[model samples]
Target: MRKTIALLAAAVMATPAAAQPTPGVRMPPEIGAAYGRLGKAMMAHDAAGVRSVWAEDFVVNSPNNEVLGREQVIAVMEQDFLDYKGFRKHITYVGQKPEVTVIMGYDTMVPIKGPGAGKQVMRPFTDVWAKRSQGWQLIARQATIAEAR
Candidate 1:
């Protein structure tokens, strides 16, 4: 009876990591994996998959107050990815605290349609990940557009 109870407790504890959304700030192994999947999904233009890496209350700030829900966020991200052809992002893991993660990266996306049609603009991006019940999910993200020198 004791062993069975203990096993059940363990399973219950691990359930969230197995199925919950990525944590908000903490980048544990599961959280990191989710983020990695998210980046790949973004590159592949998979909106639903990308949004899964974010928490339910995710806020994105690209110099705009685009506070959106999970669905809305996915829609915006999908549109952005589709509109920008050569979208490339190089992410660097800066540091991690108890409940937050700081990542610094640069993104280059072509604004035009065809290949090599528009200018390749590079912008610095910072995303804050939070550790939620699920895993490491993105809580807030911001980017500043800059011209490559």
Candidate 2:
């Protein structure tokens, strides 16, 4: 019994605390899947794919301090200004309501274009999504650079 207890404790200690889901924060599988598609679209720079995930009036308060519309963001992606070789979103908070769902997370990426090129950067982000006629679409976002290496 002692050996079994010690092994269990060791396993728990070895686990990353941040990897644990936040209490009372449950994300619907549909929203999680949509986020996955968005990441893939962004990485591929597929304008149509991106549009599918973003609402027509989608806007973002960019880290550059500019409020950009969906078209503007697409333009940036086309220009390779937002190109990234690696991207990971670490969702820490999730709030779901009848009309909308809000998620707060940090994204770590290695940019291959624009500022901080060829370096790993961590940005804290908030994404607001709504269930539209088609499906869940991102309506707003705010991303801020927290660290760069």
- Candidate with the greatest TM-score versus the true structure: 2
For residues 113-143, could you state the per-residue lDDT of candidate 1 as single tens digits? 3223376766666777888877788877766
For candidate 2, report its TM-score.
Answer: 0.80
Off by over 4 Å in 1: 1-32, 64-69, 78-86, 112-117
List the lowest-lDDT window of 10 residues for candidate 1.
Answer: 8-17
Instruction: In model 1, state the lDDT of residue 9.
Output: 17
User: What lDDT would candidate 2 get against the real structure?
Assistant: 0.66
Tens digits of per-residue lDDT for model 2, 1-149? 33322212111110111222456768777787777777667666778988998899988876545676888677656654545555666778988988799988776767664556677877777888999999898998887777779
TM-score, prediction 1: 0.61
What TM-scores do the predictions have?
0.61, 0.80
Superposition-based RMSD of candidate 2 using all C-alpha atoms, in angstroms: 14.0
